[model samples]
Target: MLEVTLEILRFFVLALALGLFIHADRSVSYGRRGFLLIKIGFLLILFGVFMEITDQLDIPGWGMVADVHVNFYLAKVVGQLAGSVLLLVGLWFWLPSIRTMDEVQEALDRARSELEEHFVARTRELEAEVDRRCKAEAEGRISDERRRILFENSPIGITHGFVGGRFVERNRAYARMLGYDSPEEMAQAQALAGDTFSHIVDPADVERIVGQARNEDYVKDLIVRMRRKDGEIRWIRLEMAMARDHHGRNYYFYAFALDVTERKERSEALERYKRRLKGIFDSLPVGIFVVDRETHTMAWANPEALRMSGYTLDQMIGLPCREALCGDASFCPWGGIEEGVPCTDESFLTRKDGTRLPVLKNMVSTVVDGRESLVVSLQDISEQKRLEELREDVNRIVTHDLKGPIIGVINGCRLLLLEEESLDAELSEMLHLIENQAEKALQMIGLSLALYKIEAGTFTYEPEPVAVMDVVRETLVNLGGRIEDKRLAVSVLLDGGPDPGLGSPMIPANPLLLETMVANLLLNAVEAAPEGGEVSVGLEQGDPVVLTMVNAGAVPEALRETFFEKYSTGGKPGGTGLGTYSARLAAGAMGGTVELSVSDDEDRTTLRVTLPGA
Candidate 1:
């Protein structure tokens, strides 16, 4: 066992000598201390192998070799050999890697220096760019300041405020226009002036402006009334806009104001002129109408026009003028006038009752609301036409009636002269009759002239105290011949009193007109009654005086409907159809009314005249 141990120790010394030699060569070449570690590691591996071999050989006096197997001994030998070779090869490979590592470190150090220099240059360039931008911004702010100063010095009013209701800026023009001496004075009194400004605006307008400022961020050309320092009101047109600042806050509101008082006054004056024009249109006496050209509809009409056409303005406006009122199918006068056609000739205007009135219309076309329209004026000529016809009839009647009377008078004179020698009492009597009739004919002509005067509204009244009974007796006496011829029985009833003189006969209304109307009514009553029929005349006195004439005759139903209409008579023989009409007109002129009605049984008809009493 000692021998084996001595051999193993000798083998270990040999392996260490070999490793030291290789490591010494590598250290000399590479000049690295790390090569010594490989030499030490090789020595430790050699020592472990040699101890195993010595135990296997069992050298004398060394120790006991404990179960040394052949395979273990061989493993020890092979491990020592492999360790020496690995140490030598490691020296060679590590020397080159160390030199290569030194070169790589040198290159890394150079690259790091270049990267640092480039980074530093890039940082400085960024700082320079930043500085340039900052300077540019500063210069831009200065330019903006100059521009703002120029704008503030101008005549226009400019102002700016913050969203939180603070006036941040205002121009001199704005402050002076609002009656302030300077912008500082206005800003110093911000709280007081703000309250005053809000108060000057209508409450609704203030709320609307505030809401718009908050929500919309802009408002423009809003006209509002503002009060000045002297308590005078003026109109202003306001423009406003909003802006956000760099801090991402909505901080500024800008506004511009212009005075519009003059314009407002002009508008008001124009409105007043329009009202005056409308008044003139409304007050015209003749019927006037205006029609739209496109629609051919009555766009505007005066009250007189509406009354003449028998339609309300609402029913007529926006309605085709002719179709709505006249119902004419062929040529509409209003439409023709609107189309600029001349219609100066006489035309008929139809009423709601389907009655046509003869009218002379004149038309002109003009522009209204930038559209062509027509204005029409109408004058009713029916009464003038009727008067002309009456004049011709009167001439004929007068000529015929006068001619007969003249002829009779001439004939009577001739007969009296020629037949005087052979004249008897009978011939003398006949000639006297002819002269009396001629005198009556002259009186009839005078009566006709009086009637014509009354119809023409030229008759005058002279009221005096007259006894009612005397007036009645006189009227009866005047018609006594006719009464006797008709054999009419007439009676008067003075009800409710023994007359008390009726206070001087009920205030003596126009005696002539009153007596004439009463006489006409009485004569008609007598003519209407059958023989033995009684006609009663009665008088009642109260606050008002009433004279009633009742006759035992039935009023024709058709005549009763239009009892007082002009030219409507009850078909009486020889009736001229003007008695009732003239009677009613005279009664109305005397501040009284005439009314007629028939009994339900159709047995009696009553006519009543009422007048104001003293």
Candidate 2:
């Protein structure tokens, strides 16, 4: 029983091993041939153990099955040997497949991890690109808004259009400038015009401007005449440029415009005035020249100026003023003349022939064409000068012819006076008056010649010591009749006092000139004194003696500047105006000066004479 039990246990152990092998076949993978081989080997081993158990039990049917196999133990041994061989062969085949399975699993795990990492990185990149695109789109919208605002609010007239006449956009200012209510109205009008600029711009101007823009692709500061909706013509200044695409083809045109009608009108008016002025200058009788201040060169010469200079306009245009007009380079009229002030004097002009012509020249500094310039006018004074010389000659001949006759009358009167004892008192007095009057006539003739010589600058000066006090007393006595007629009271003083211990003050002067000066001054004082007015004469004794004569009457305002000029008069009845003139000349000949002062406060006139004393 123990043996049977052990065999049975062996048999059960083998069957259980076979059952575990069959179960593992379902859970694990192996080639079909190898699995079949393993299953057949396990069944054979179980059958061998079952046969051994049956042999051990010695049953009648089991003996018969053993006899048919020839030996039960041998059969069991054979079956076990074959099963072991098949099991070993199956393990040999399936073990390499198991290693291959392990390698495939490791490779699949690595590929999955790599794919996960790549997917994560690509997702981040996609998100950043979306964010960047969103930011760019936002900035583009802002830029478009800014451009719209700028285009609408620009002050100057602005417009955009195709190269052909199709308008794209226009600002409010541009619309208003063209006399439209709004931009839309302007656009509607432009659309209705049917490819025409004649409705807005001058047709002729449009032709030229459009032609130029087409050729040059730009136009700047081009002035065009435009017509408003209300039928007013205006001048517009335009600046336009063409926008080209990347292929160098014109895409569109933009323009800026401003109204300049007032400026254009003013320019036209100025041109007209200049034309009139030039006409007048050409027809003038006197010579007129315009000179540049900085270069001292002639800029323009009128017709008269050209004729006087004996040169054509081309020859005189760029010549120096000193060379062309005055012939003295050192003496330019601009040197002494101030701006806006006129200078008039006598000067000589050198003609092309090298002959000097006398002229009275007037010069004034002024602005011409925005630059400092000088305007000079010259009047020929040759005929006037010749007539003055002729008059002087006649006066000289008359004075010479009258001197001998006047001397004869004075001598005859003197002879009559010498025989006073033979005549009665009345007859003797008459003869004496005749002699005095004749002497006065002779003195008058001599004075006339002396005056002529002084004017000619040919007078000979003979210096001698003269008693100024005695001369003054003699002049007062000579004017006594005039003083009495005017009812004037005359006063004389020496060294500011009534009388001084010193004798008559002496001055080194020509005796005749000294007497004439004193007499003329005193006579003028007497004549100018008002009725019942007073005249005061004061003398100061010094190295330079000063003589002052004051009268109650003041000089006339009109003649104050020319009081001592030759032939100047204040419209006094029978007044020669030569008293002050001759007095000044005689004083100047004796190296002296005569001055006149009018005191408005005291209503008085004072004549002061200063001379060298001996």
Candidate 3:
């Protein structure tokens, strides 16, 4: 074992000596002698590899060539000795003591006396060589000084330190990196600055960086948190290099430091931002699915997507987008997404149980990774569908059952009115009032049915010439009882003359819809107005006809914003909160607009309806 170990060690030393001799030998006096010595060393290494104790070679002169002592072991020892001497003679102009000539002479003489005179002669010949070597060494020193100048002035941070955790040299850039005024200041504050790695906050990190540098003889982009002179911790990426100094024979660790705080901070902040955004995405009620444009497969699914699709997270990942979202659809939106168009519609998503879930989605086509991709935002509309069904049920009951009593009451009134001739004058007047009230109730029931149709989206627009004042007068007559109870004073003004329905003041609309809209607005005005206060209804004739209703009471500030929204209303007797909403729908159906204004200081409210002129 010891013999094998010594052989391996000897092999490395001889190999190193061969390389050094060939590289450093530059003198013309050697004349390829250094290269010849390298070849000899190479042959010895090959011998060691190919030949062992069990291997032997028979030649004309075994281990010797042409009367020369060319034995393998002796050749290896000689190559090492001669290569070292020649290489030293070139670089440092030094000679080794030659005590024997048998190592160099062809006859293999071991006598030192005969070669002593020749060695003396060779020594005299090398006197001039010493002078040349001195000149070369001086030039080398100048070159080294230039290198040192470049190192000091370099912008990149550079530092050199011994293994004992003491910095031997630092450039200006390195000193500035640690927040010192100058390199000298940094040198003086070596103890405070953590010597070699005192600024490294983590001891484990220090060990890692050092170990990495030692093992690899170089380390690049080794990030560490280092403290500055002001005690501010910053991230730095150190490129470390290690080497043995040929002059001192000591190991040195050199580092090129770069301030990576900004880049690292930005990366960390971006990562943090990604985490926060992912949290928000997972918390949303709407589902978001990203699909590959080429394959149309699910690339990413947010948490909401899993919930909305009724699929487990594992099921949703990598599933075909069409299969996961709308597997039952004949025409998939993915096909259209391939054309780079954005599409949105209400559709049904099939769940795991084959139950259809109503959904509304916005699918946009975009390019990603050199291919088309779809980013789908989904909303579950099941609740909206349920509410619509409930509303339809309510409307159905009113249409089929609730109108019977109103018609029966009207028929009873008609029978009593027919016997007016046999009754007294006061009783006849009472019967006439009952008949009018009953007719008004019937009209309200019919209007309710029409509103239901309008809500169901089954009502069609019927445009006809209609008058604002005529509708207003009919509403006042129908609501006469309520008006008298409130004691509200109402006034009507027509700007298009008495026959307002004949010309400019007339608006094109379904007469029934116009009447409903006017009656609701008039009722709101009457109900909001104080007793004995005025409700002025005015009709203006122009390119667009305007009907303005002004009441003596201001709308509540809180209700003003959502006054026209469905199911939005303030405290009022018999208020269903659908009056303004229906009125706005009616005006919209007739290509008109409705606007409300209030003067809180004056306690007044005005609703203006702008309609297309006849």
What value of lDDT does candidate 2 attain over all alpha carbons?
0.81
Instruction: Report the lDDT tens digits of candidate 1 across residue range 1-614.
Output: 56676766677677767666675663354534446545654765566566566556556544334654444543455455555565666666566767776887798899999999999999999999999999999999999999787767968778777764756787888777767788887766656655635424577766666667666667888887776555677788888897867875556778787888888899899899999978887887678878887788889888878878787889778877676334355766543554555556567677766688777777788877888887777777889889977985887587557867576686766667577667788877777777766665654454455555566777665666546656666667777787678777877777644433333355667665666677777777778877777778788876578888888878887678678877888778899887888788767767789988888686998998887776
Model 3: weakest 10-residue lDDT segment is: 93-102
TM-score of 1: 0.43
Query: Which numbered prediction scores highest in lDDT against the true structure?
Result: 2
The order by descending lDDT is: 2, 3, 1
Q: What tens digits encode model 2's per-residue C-alpha lDDT throughout 298-397?
A: 9988999888889899988888888767647576556788999888778877887877778888899999989899999988877878888898789778
Estimate TM-scores for all models. Answer: 0.43, 0.69, 0.51
lDDT per model vs. reference: 0.71, 0.81, 0.75
For model 2, state the Cα shift of residue 209 in Å. 3.1
Q: How big is the positional error of residue 472 in model 1, measured in Å on the Cα after superposition?
A: 62
- lDDT measured at residue 527 in model 1 versus the true structure, 0 to 100: 80
The reply for model 1, stretches above 4 Å from the true place, is 1-80, 84-156, 179-212, 215-224, 229-231, 239-252, 321-345, 351-355, 380-614
| Residue-pair clash count for candidate 3 | 2
* lDDT tens digits by residue: candidate 3, 119-207: 88778778768878888899999999998998899888888887546678889988888798888887777666555667788998888
